[model samples]
Target: MNSASVISVVGPTGTGKSALALSLAEILDGEIVNADSMQFYRGMDIGTAKVSVAERRGIAHHLLDILDVTEEASVSDFQRQARQAIAEIQGRGKRAILVGGSGLYVRAVLDVLEFPGTDPRIRQRLEVEAEAHGMAELRARLQRVDPASAERVADDRRVIRALEVHEVTGKPFSSFMPVREYIQPTVQIGLDIPRPVLHERLSTRVNQMVDQGLADEVERLDQRGLRTGKTAGRALGYAQFLRVLDGEATVAAAAEETIIATRQFARRQSTWFRADPRIRWLDPREDDVVDQAAALCL
Candidate 1:
């Protein structure tokens, strides 16, 4: 790692990404950095599966729960905080182990994106359009405007973001996501799990979260006056549960809907990682993930 490299763990949720990263941190003398966007909140613990201090076990973790739920933390903020975390870990003669399923957050921190600073007017107007015309409409707009880019990222969030970039930077958003030169000499590892098994695990996890008072957690956060527009508020489980609260769906329906949405999101994540040529993919159950990862780093 040349004393300054970062170790990145990425994949869909239920792929043992956190477990693998924590294990690798202990073995490799590394400090864990939170890369998941939802885990960055303080109160939403169970649903986010935030690593407990006991789980961290004093190995030194960074950039988790640094912002209040009300604050709007952007990709730029993640990049800034992540660099500081890596520098601190490197300064201590330890490797930095990044752990999460938030590929955009990981990519932003690793500088895979040439991430132009956002223009407020462009974002504000687009956000308004997204709210008015719906995610589908905005996605169609992106397809019409940038067909090639649309094929790569058809999600509502990415579509809106691409439109914002085009409006502000006069360039397509896909340009930033593929700027691989911005990355350090990072060793990327992925956890591979079968699709059906992954779906079962996600369903079980969501149920466990509900039993762990996920509803109460969301209610508390809601009372804090956090807006729906904020990223933290739109976390997978919480976002769907809010629909139940609004009488739009039953609790069971919400849970099932969340599971389906998550699985689809996972598929998209898998595709995104596939497009990156530098990553080394592996399975948690096959051999030692650490041994395989260490071999790659060396």
Candidate 2:
């Protein structure tokens, strides 16, 4: 009876993963720990869809909004904090429900991968190149070094991170990647809906964020001088909003750009989660996602 068994709610954005996690937390007397990268920052509410105090439904949540927008938070930071929270919850004889759409952060927590440590010189070089030739070019270079890792992480940021491993450690990125590690006593749940439905929901969700003052949130962060180099500042909506704030783009254009970027991010999440065998994929229309999760937990 390892109460430490994690109940992880994972899916692309706008799929009600948070809602499912909260409901299961309440039913199972569990505590929820955020796995989303964006949701970890303070003052990043609307666009991150951060669970508000009221919306927590009197359930305890961990690792949300503990960092300033100017801080540099990475997968290693997340993994350390998440593992601590999980241990604490299990010590309290409660369950830990890991919830979010950030597939990298989620996998880092569930698996045994050791993310490469950062090096100042390599990072400075990559930053210069990333801003010069673009993140795509760096990602392509990573593909030449390790195609398997590239497929598992088919994006600029992750590919850049894997590249960092190779450059810093003088080892192929895959050489550092951990072999498959089961999350002992853990059960994973992935949520999915029809593509049309999901996209429609995504559109409405973005519009709702606009109405809920996401622009103002970004503006506040901007006023604080939290530029795009910081983790929180680089969050999708904030980056687009930064364009509008810089007078580099129009409101309509920025909003459209945000939507387009988010859609592509969701596509990548689906690709990774679909390939993760640990997750028990479930339809969003399933009669009882929590019940199914609890069954798996037992």
Candidate 3:
């Protein structure tokens, strides 16, 4: 492996990626660059399970809390920032450890991914059409233009972006998808845990967050324009708890919903990361998992 190669710790949520990344950084004299999209927003800490300053153990971490809740995060911008951070870390003679469960964001840093540029006029036109015609209409249009992306994209935001890409660049959005090929020397370590174990862990973690005043945290952020945040407002716990604030649900109900949503999200994450052949899988339950991962990096 190249000495300056990036070490990426990736997996589903509640799989101990952060803990392993911390251990790897300590052992390899590394700095951490966050790839989790949710962790980018300030005041999103408790819900995102952001590692605290004390928990970081003085390890320099880049790209956490860099955006306000109201601002949307762009994968293209993050790719630039993360690569710059990695280069700076390498230039200082320290390894750069990339950590997070956000699969697309991770790939944006490690893989040969190209993001399509957006034109606001085109996006606004699409948005208006969707509102006037409905998502079913828009989805049908997308199917006509880009069958692959239409099949893959489910959300309103991405569907519009796909149409916008087709309009502006006259190319399918799927064409810009990341290839498995790495852009640089990299070793990706994926934590493998049983589905049953992961589900239980996610449930327990969500409950713990509730006990730790996740509602209060959400309330504080809500006062800070969190509701206006297109990305952060829709996060796993934050969205559910936002209902609590609206009197549409109780805290317990929100926690239960968050647990179910998180488990589903984790399943999607597992599917995404498992598709990548480059990642070396380690059962985090193993006694010598850290040693095994360190050996791969070395």
Candidate 4:
């Protein structure tokens, strides 16, 4: 890896990426840049498992807690902000360590990705159509217009965006997909964990979040227009806990649901990162994992 190139720590959730990133930063004289989309929002700490200030060990971190709960996160915006942060860090003669499980957000920063322009009129029309007709209806439209994106994208938001892009740009949204080519000389370190162990860790983590007042955190954010926020409202634990606040589920039931959802999300994340051939995979269980990762950076 080039001495000035950014280092990324990526993998599924609960795989100890943050701890490794912190260690790498300490060893390499690096600053941390968050790539997790959910971690962008303020007052979302507990459920997102955002590292606390003290846990940072005086290391400088960027792109975290910069948005309110009501705002939607944009990958295009994150790309700009993260690149600027990386450039500044490099200019200061320090390494830049990017860390998160959000696959697309990470790619947006490190890979040659370009976002298509958006028109409010087209977006609003699509949103209204989705609300009136349903996501299945829009997804069917997406399937007809951009079958590749339709097959790959599973979220309602991306489904609508795909359709909007096809309409506005006269091209398939998949055409804008990033190639694996990196924009800079970079090294990605992925943490590999056993499936059964990851499942248990996710379950235990969700239960611990509940114990650590995930419910209270959700309740507080709900007052701050969390439900009105399109992106934040759908976050794994927050969504289930919101059901609890609505009397639709109990805390125990919400925690169980969150565990299942998080496991599924982790599986998707693992699949995404696994597809990238450039990342160096390491077993986090090994005692020399940090040393192995540092050696790769050098």
Candidate 5:
């Protein structure tokens, strides 16, 4: 592997990205820089499927467990931290293996995308619009200004941010879309699975998380003010389990909802990653998947 090149392992959740990243790190003398937004929180272990220290096989991992649940995760922050980690890894004569399915986070690290500064007054106005007229209204307004970004911004928060960027920069948010250029040499290996197979896998994974005490995990975090967290509170499994804790749903019902939400999230991940032509696709189930990825890095 080229010492200056970073290896990125990305796919939908439950597609063995962690496993592949571990393998690549073992082979390439690499350390990991996480891009999974949820994994940034300290105690969000089971639901995010964070690889335990024992599971990492003594390989170094960076950018995990670096945030409190109450703090909002900023992509610009992640981009800076991740690039620093990668540079340090490479400076130490090791490879940097980037992992996770968060597409924008991944792009922030690898692409030449510039984040426009936010104007407090503009953001305040957008927030008011979102609150009074609903996300659909702001989304429709965004479509008029930046149709491409409007298509990608799914949630109220992102829609607000996109509009804030457009207002602050006097440019459409879509005009800031990442070009096929890298800040540094990088190789991205994407794991691909059939939709039915991925769905089944995701369902089974959610059940495994439940069995592993995801509900109890959420309850513990709740005591630490997880519900008050802007970002952490809305995580996939944690949010559903919070409903269970509130007596709004049964554990079984929460699990079902989590499964459904996870499937939808996976579809979005697929769409985000499939648009990147730089990623080399491979099947995680292939016996030599790690070798295939390593070949690309070389």
Candidate 6:
């Protein structure tokens, strides 16, 4: 493989993406660029399943733990940083491996996606409309105008962004769907796990997180202003645990809800990535996953 080739390992959260990426980096003399949005926060290690220093096996990793819990993650910002990291790694004659299950973040790094400049007036107007009509109504309007964008972006913030883009550019947000092309020389590998097994694994993973003091982690972050952060406050496990802190639910109940939400998220990720034909799918249970992916890279 050329030194400039970028390899991305993507799948659901519990699919062992980090392990595969570690192996690939060791074999390919690569450095990792993280694409998981949640892992951007510095102290969100346990909930996001960030690989520990020991697990990284001394491979240089970039873009992990760069954001505070109170900061909103911007895909556009991440795109810039990730591209720079890739260039730097490849410039050093090493491989650049992008690893995560965040579908849009992955595309932001690899695809020819342009982040449009926002108009404050348009954004303000959309915020007012969302406040007056509600997020569901605003999302419904976006569904009519840009169904493709509406399908993937369900958050109020992202829906507002889509509408703002449409108003500013006079183009449907869906018109920006990434072409089946890469901005850089790249190969993508996806893990294929059965739904039943994935769901069970997700549940077990959530249980493990709880055992690893997820509640305490959330408590620490909450005290550190996580509640004020628009994006981080709504993260899957942290949000559920916040309810636990409020006495609205038990930690057990929170874990169950997190499991369900993670399963749904995995389904969405699967759908998003399956639509891309360039990704080479492999069964994670297979012993030769690293070899299979390395063959594609080389």
Residue by residue across 178-211, what tens digits does model 4's lDDT show? Answer: 9999999999999979999999999999988998
| Residue pairs in collision within model 1 | none
Q: Which parts of model 2 have CA positions greater than 4 angstroms off?
A: 1-4, 126-160
Model 3 segments beyond 4 Å from truth?
none
TM-score of each: 0.87, 0.88, 0.99, 0.98, 0.95, 0.94
**Model 6, 5-79: lDDT tens per residue?**
899999887988999999999999999999999999989989999999988899999999998889989988999
lDDT of 5: 0.91
lDDT of 3 by residue, 40-111 (tens): 999899999999999999999999999999999999999999999999999999999999999999999998
Candidate 6: 10-residue stretch with minimal lDDT: 172-181
- Backbone clashes in candidate 5 total 0
**What C-alpha lDDT values do all the predictions have?**
0.79, 0.82, 0.95, 0.95, 0.91, 0.91
For candidate 2, write residues 132-169 as lDDT tens digits. 98877887788798787887775466677778888788
> Native-vs-model 4 lDDT?
0.95
Clashing residue pairs, backbone N/CA/C < 3 A, model 4: none
Model 6 bad stretches (over 4 Å): 1-3, 140-152
Error of 5 at 242 (Å): 0.5
List, residue by residue over 127-194, the lDDT tens digit for candidate 5: 88778887888889899999998887777888898899988888988788788798878889999799
lDDT string for model 1 (1-298, tens) is: 5545788999888788878888788778888999988788777787788888888767788888887777766777888889888888888899998888887788888865667657778878888987887788777788887777889875566677788888888777766764665467788888868888888888998888888887778778878754454777777888887777778888788888888888888887888777778788998777666688777655
Model 5's C-alpha root-mean-square deviation from the true structure amounts to: 1.5
User: How high is the lDDT of residue 109 in model 6?
Assistant: 94
Candidate 2: residue 227 Cα off by (Å): 2.3
Of the pair 1 and 5, which is ahead by lDDT?
5
Off by over 4 Å in 5: 1-3
Error of 3 at 181 (Å): 1.2
**Candidate 3 — what's its lDDT?**
0.95
